[model samples]
Target chain A: MSFPKLWSFHGGLRLDGHKQESTRLPLRAARLPERLVFPLLRRDGRLAAPGAKPGDRVLKGQLIAGGDERLDPPIHASTSGRVRSIEELPLPHPSGLAGPCLVIEADGEDAAVEIEGLANYREHPPEELLRRVHQAGIVGLGGAAFPTAVKLAPAGRRIDTLIVNGAECEPYITCDDSLLRHRADEVLQGAELLRHILHAERCLLAIESDMPEALTTAERALREGGFDRIAVVPVPAIYPTGGEKQLIRVLTGREVPARGLPADVGVVCHNVGTVAAAYRAVVLGETLTSRIVTVTGRGVRQPQNLEVRLGTAIADLVAQCGGYTDEAERLILGGPLMGFALPSDELPIVKSAHCVLVAGRGELAGSRPAQPCIRCGACAEVCPAQLLPQQLYWYSRSDQLERVLDHRLFDCIECGCCDVVCPSHIPLVQYFRAAKGKAIAKQREREQADRARRRFEARQARKAEEARERAEAARRKKENLEKSAVPEIRQAIERARRKRAEKTDQHATSDTPGRS
Target chain B: MLALLAVCLLFALFGLLLSYASRRFKVEGDPLVDKIDAMLPQTQCGQCGYPGCRPYAVALARGEADINQCPPGGEDGVKNLAELLGVESKPLDTARGTEKPKAVAVIDEAACIGCTLCLQTCPVDAILGASKFMHTVIAAECTGCELCLAPCPVDCIRMAPVRETAATWRWPEPGAVRP
Candidate 1:
């Protein structure tokens, strides 16, 4: 397994993967939840509006809710069911706030609505292909959940390169690694489809150099499939070498501008898992029904990667992994660094779920009292973004908003590198997050204030216009009266008197006739 | 004598070039210093043991300020600083205090009167209601520094454990494994 083209970055720590227990186990299917609560919002935090009413019978893969075309992806039914109700339910969100959800009671019959398969999807135009992808509710399954169609769509500028990210850079995450080892062919096929869609000149599949087996498997698949233009490039096993921007820089040596996207530099990056999903969608006309998820940690009775449905509960997934050990103190969704800590096992797995870890209490039991920073330079040594973490922490702590922005606070990817290597655990990431949150809140406040100002201005303009119209009407009436002579005025007065008299006479006549 | 003068002139020219080169090539300080400084938990608690968070940030930029300092900032703050500084981190400095999970500021709603002291102390304006009314801490804005907890004259303020959501749930550290 000679992975000649592998590249990596500096400053990443290698934790024990503990993958042996689960890597060899064949993928298992997760049992369905009795009731499915599907959130209308999945991508970029924008909520999708409900398309179905209460009591509507929906089949699996049926469109139940649709996103606003501008920023949302359409949502579909995960199973055949009757709409129980459209109500507020606890969504799988960090905020833990209840969002509007479509609740469905499973009918136990996995019935699916008829889907229109592309007779020759590969032959279809790129625009049409992207349209189907949007309608299919495809999102980046690699945890970002970015809308896939938006990535596939041609940018305002030309796209020359497409990088397929296969760097399963997180310590415990092996879903992508396993996918490469087991399903390399699908990944390559997906890559080819992406190339065709983007019409890109170069297609590079970037994988970590650690997994030699995956590299070989991917190489063989690429060669067997005759994808000559697609190169399987191995990146170094850095912690966040798998981050889109970092991977792009390592592979192409092109720095994705800070806060800018790979597409801005004529490159579009896709997660290997995302590409596999695309292949399934475009090649087999399959919707995103199931995905390969890595289930490994110290607290699980068993550890293995399993194929699970979109709305499967974490509890069911855990049971599939032979249930949790008594020592299991915490459960995390996704990888250890970026994964969210799950409040409960009842949370449903969505498209972005990659790993479900059950770690023991003892495994997480170290509590260090935060000490004063002794001005150690260790954080800068490990920052892949070349940022000054200590300074940002200071400004954020002081609530100095201007200095935080000046430091390009938005460019921080929150990868947890500086905190990991710090001699003193400064909780650097929290300060950055606090600053970012404060910044966002401040921006929202400013926007609201601007909107209020605009409304006030509009109201004032309307009021002035109304007053002017009233004054104009009064002047016109006065002019008409002034233009008339004395005789004309007398005649007009007599006419008005006659008209009033006639109206009174008619009213009296009608009343008298009715009485008679 | 002329050759000696020529040699002296050559030395002077070399000295000038060296000074000019040194000035031109001096490493510019990172712009992220200010931002990283702002993100520091400004309890000015001197928990980082420096004069303040600002001095610590300068030291951090000058390769000072260990990533693990302010206990008030906790693990989240450490992670943010790590991201900002572009460094890897280990466990929180055990010397400072172990990083605990998320907690929120809780006011014992039953503790008689609202003195409004906690409201004035809150940096983010997290406390709500008038001076006379019972004030509440907005859990979202509360950093859980326990700064507000100490100011309560009646010991009415308590640090309540933050509600765990699927989002805040993290896998227990692998080191928790006892061999």
Candidate 2:
């Protein structure tokens, strides 16, 4: 059957889909690693305060860190283990700075944590379903681990549609594709639940047209499961089609306003993997313990997709996959478009990690020394957000922050489509990221200065008030002394004169030596 | 003669509208002084020989105080203030004090005699205590002016520099500090 007709986003690229090496093999189960270092910092770079201390025994799937899901998702132990230590460890970041992490040594038992699950989710109201999702530590697994519960809460906003994103647009990141292919029934089941929770009239699952096989599988599962409310739509295979705004635009022909969210425009979007996780969270009594991770690249000896447990060290997975080839050069954590290079293999795979990319010496063919821009408008042409990448590049490079701010610098999503087509090979996205950081830091400094100024003013006002009260008290005391007795003032004057004479007499004896 | 009278009447109406617009949009106070005060750190240290930053700002607005007098406001601070006031930036005065890191006073409660001497010396009244009890400085409101350090009878006060926490820490500025 023909998929639903699609509309086009402004600009994108059809980058070579380097997905074959991994998808050739059916999904595999990763071997258990001996030690799991759960980064105390959540995937959003927030501190995940530990719930267990060192030497404490933690069962598999037990809550190990994170306080509330409103700000960040809670982290769970991947296997039954003993807390080894909580200290600094190499993290999955380009900066090379270490992060706080909880080290747990597995006991090989794989015992499950004691928890309860819902028997029938439909019996519960929508608010209860939201709480369950929050407790299960569910997030948008697509790069941005935005807390899902925040989006589901209408908070006085009306929503009409729920979009399930199964595009898997980034090359070599096929976890969502595999999940849809194998677990279509579960994904749709989760989508139906999401539709109900959001109170949306229609639920649409958008997949990239290139992945026809997965789309057919998902649609057949939808029909077999009698989920008439949900339909599968295949959009063009464009890079960044899975971006929340771009996906919404491609499917519904609506643009999420700048500096706003999808719910503002009567819609909400979730990754298909996120939806499937929600389904399992409500029905199967499972936390987000494991997910399908793509381990592929020319540099890897055995490139395939595997269901790896969260908090598992990357080095162990590399060893289990027959180690890296001699030609391996750089190790990247996510898709090449938006991911950063991992400083070391000791960094654990985080929840937002969808791929472990190992590029051989020549794998990055076009990525070379950046050249000067040729005043070409290609970047602006391909920008899905329709931002002026060239103008921002010039303003940012010159450190003209105010000028760039006026030009709407934050609107660029850093999708790497412009970098792909630039004739001069300028890394436009890098410039934008640096400029954004500088801008934010400057804004913070100004705010602090303003706060200091207000406090100083308040302090001065308080001091003046105190001085006034003190002077009034002294005046009232003198008046009381005069009113009590008329001769009291004369007596006080005599006492003051005697005290002054004594001070002068002492000074004369000490300095003049009786000459006076 | 009638045409000339018509022209005079039109001129009167336009003049009234213009005057009303000017009066309605008249700005109050010296904006330059407020802007200059904003550039100052507002430490109220009295290091510049002014009672507070606001009086010093007034003097600057009146062209009486030099831009170089504020030592608490370091060279960058002076530069910012000068830029706002349309004057040439100069070095900070060495007599007051050198540019210092942000600091706060921490009282050694055990050593403190509860004499309340520091309470009177603090310009900001950041210290809180009864006459015979131990005093504690509110860290948030403290200006790090060092005025309270001199009057502590037992020398129980220490000027402690602020430490950076994980939240306060930032990725070093690109190019200035590589990685």
Candidate 3:
């Protein structure tokens, strides 16, 4: 398969992939551990409310925790398990924060649930298919983990192109590559299903040029499946070329507006894993209970991809990968460039986790004392978003949020490209990330203040109106009393005159005009 | 003598144009006051010796109030106010009160006497209760002004520090870099 033209993004790195280390072995299934910990909290801070109580027996694929379709992706029991307890446990984050999680002890039976699928999904409405996807708890497996159903349904827009992103450009993450090489047919079918749902004109299946096997396998699958609408295209293996915005630019040469989604450009991009998950959800009636994770690095004895169940501990995955090697020094999630270090290996995997990179000593860059930036412009030159990193760093450090905002700080994407190229060895992306948080918080505070101000004004207006009504009522009461008193005073005077006239008549009669 | 007469005539014409412009573009309200008010945190706690944020903003716009009088606004607030009013920023006036972390008025319902005093004092009407009935604070609307605290005869209302939950936990500013 060939493309008419290929485009390139502004700035990216050509780092050593180290992907072959994990792809050396075929994908294998991870054995279910004794205990599975499912953290209810998502990376975005949304909580999936627990649906099953402790001590309750649950079947595989049964919903254990529920979530809002748009915010939280529902969690299901990975295997038939008895609920141990739902309590707080350490989450998989850089901060090592504790959050509420569901602890399930697998019974080892792997009991099945009644599986159903829409054999004729084409006959159903798009909304129904979208509902099924949401029910399946599928999210973008490309690390963003945004709700796939919500992304697929772009309101008030027309989708002309759908990009099946197999471009796993991050170093040491070969989960997508393995999935494409093995299950390319399922992914293509999923792409066809997505096309029917989106009513897109054509679909572009983008794979990184480095993965010759994945590219070849996908091409064969497309040919065998007669997927005329889907084309297998190879994108250059750039560091962040897999980023939603950057990938869109590389394929279509259309820059997604800052803070805008690909759907805004008449295109929709989905990870190859997410598409395959969607296909499974619609065709096989399977919930997202497991995912393909690449457990590799110099730290582990064996480096390979494992189709692991959700809620499996990282330690278990490492143990399955032959445990830690003598040189094992650091445990990081995702790629070395973007992934954060986990404090311990006891953290459970979630739907979003694609890579578990355990780095050996000196395998990762050690922090050096940061020197003052000399305005070298190297960071700017390598910034994929083409932002002036030095200016942003200065403004962010000085708390000049207005200037940072004016420079379009939200567009930074925290890709760490600037951090990689900075001669000063400063953590520029960290600064940007911290500043972005502050900026968002400031925005929220302003919104809350504005709301309070409006409420206060409304209350003032209401109080004033109430006071005026009370005063008007009091004035009306006084006027009514005055008007009522006039009649009583007039009646008293009339009675007094009658009594005086009667007395006068009585006196005249007594003085001998008696009959008169 | 001819030049002096022309200068006097020109000044008179300029004055007439200024008067006309002022009358033709007469503004109903002081927009400066609104700008000053927008800079305020709008807690309506009256820590600035005004009835509310807008009154203090009005005073500030009229050059009658000091920029440091607001404690709820804190140092950051003072900076914002100073920038907006084009004045030098100063520390918050400790005479009014010290700046505290963001909090909300939480009513101890069991200890509440149901006097409804807080209901009347709340600037935003965040309290919901009737005479001789339990009053609960609508936490979302409560500005944590402490105005309600004083009005509670039972002393049941207290300011509880807002805890950072998963949703509200923000990334802390990065500290000094380590080698």
Candidate 4:
């Protein structure tokens, strides 16, 4: 296998890999919870509509929410159950807000409706295959949860490199690691399918060098699966290296354009789990109803990875992992660097619920007030996106949004690297996020005003042009009338002159006869 | 003496070019009015006691109207206009209308006379109906101008705040999220 010449990224962190606590145990499927809450929207604030309501019977793997032209992913019921109520439930977001969700009271039957899959996916057109992936509701399981089907190559767009991102770079997140280790063949099948659909020249599987087990597994699987194009390329252990653009740069030395996608550089990246889900959707006739989650932290009695049913109350899953040992004060949902603190464990797992870190009391909580910036350049040193976080913070705090935008505040991925290394304990990512939101809101407002102005100006211009046309037409009509009247007036003048001459001649002749 | 005359002639020629260029690119009306209009929430709601946002902007540009006359723009809108026009920000005019939440006109179908009065009065033409058929508000296009509210003889048209859905829900501030 010709592993593409390895490349390096600009800035990254050597984080403490706490993978051993979780990866020790083999992956297990958690027992189905009696009650589950399915938020209508995903954590990233995606818009989904609930198709099932209170007192509606739904089967496992049955579509219950979403499927809109907005290109949002559809959500399926994880188990056969009746929806008890559909209302606001606690969601796993940085902002602790409750959103509308579908609450299902399990019937405990765990029955599913028969799912159909295409036997020969190769025979079908790429669009048809992509449509099935869309119908199956597959999204990037790595984190963003952006619809995966939209990432498919557009017709005539040459997609040369398909990067299968198995690099579980974030600390304390071993779900992707475990997924690759257990189901490398399945992931390869999905990547191969993606390659076929995208017609990519090469497929690169990037895994962190720390994950020797997953790398060995992928290597063996690639050997056995007979995928001529795919190869396993292990990267150095780094925080935020798993980021889409960062991973692409690490593998191919190509930088994704700002405010653009990987496809802009003839590359497409998919999470290993997402590709696995696509494989199941296109081959075995399955839906993305469950995902592997790493339930690990210093506070938990046991740390293990569980293949959790979607909408399963996280507290129940914690109990299945032998419950909390200490008062797990900081309940973070994802890895430590970027994960948000959850108010409670009762919140159910959505598709993006990859990790549920239960930190001890005051672990994730901030205690110190923000000190003044000491002109320290520590934040700039650690930014993976190579942004000046300190400058962004100053502009953001002063509400100098124009300056903030000039500094490319949006490029800061909110990875919390600056927050970790800051001597002042400054939450730099939070400031950048707030600033980015404000900037985007300002942009949207400007766009709305521009639209309205365009409409108003167009209306005014059309009216003015119409008035000008009317005046021109009236002028032309008057000119035509004057032109036609000119000859008649001339004829009248000629007749008058001739009559006067005749009168003179007759008078002269009469007078001359008298004189003679 | 000849050289001096030549210099004078050169100055005159340059002055003519400058004058011609100035006339060729002359902008119409006050450019300040366009800037002020861009700041107004372009809802065209006429809540500013003028015909539309642009007309109100024109009045402001002429120093005939106060910047605070626009309620739809709210206080921030006034501040933006004030900052642009170099004036002090003032509270919105209550006589014209107070800054209320965004609302759409809802027609009570039972009480609707189907007079099409509301449809005619709507600035954005968000209300749809025939002369004798019941009209409904296309919620997406409704600017909540409330122009249609007064024209209804039967008082069937009611202005209601737009409802919040998951799609419209915004991320709450960190301090605002109740534990």
Residue-level lDDT of model 1, residues A1-516, one tens digit each, is 123443445455665555566676766666776787777654444456788899999888888887548446677788888999987666666555566677888898989877766747667888888877777778887788888889887568688889899988887778888888889999988888888899898789988878888999999998788888798987777778888888877877788888777888899999999998888777777777677888888888888888777777788888878898888888888776676666778777778889988877756422455666777878777777878888787787777888988988888888888877767767677678767877875565445334433433354466679999999999998777757677878688779989999999999998997898
- Across A1-516, the per-residue lDDT of candidate 4 in tens digits comes to 688487878778898888999999999889988887888865344557788878999998889998844258788999998999978776766656678889888999999888788868999999888888987888889888888898984545679999999899888889999998899999999999999999998899999999999999999999998998998899889888899989999899999989988888899999999999999999888988999999998878889999999999889988988899867777889888888778778888888889999987665535467788886999889888888888988988888888989999878887888888889987777677667767766776678666655655565676679999999999998667656658886677679889999999999999998999
Task: Note each model's CA RMSD in angstroms.
Answer: 18.2, 5.4, 7.7, 9.3
Scoring only the A-chain of each prediction against the true A-chain gives TM-scores of 0.90, 0.92, 0.90, 0.86
All models: lDDT?
0.75, 0.83, 0.89, 0.84
Evaluate chain B of model 1: give its TM-score. Answer: 0.57
Report the poorest 10 consecutive residues by lDDT, candidate 3 chain A: A477-486
Clashing residue pairs, candidate 2?
none
Q: lDDT per residue, candidate 3, A248-273, as tens digits?
A: 89899988988888999999999999
TM-score of every model versus the real structure: 0.70, 0.85, 0.90, 0.84
Name the regions of candidate 3 deviating beyond 4 angstroms: A42-46, A67-69, A481-516, B1-28, B176-179
Q: In angstroms, how far off is A380's CA in candidate 1?
A: 1.4
Better of 3 and 4 by lDDT: 3
- Candidate 4 CAPRI assessment class: incorrect
Off by over 4 Å in 1: A1-10, A42-46, A67-70, A364-367, A485-516, B1-179
lDDT comparison, 1 vs 3, better candidate: 3
Better of 3 and 4 by DockQ: 3
lDDT of each residue in A418-464, candidate 2, tens digit only? 88889887878888888887887667656756666776667778878
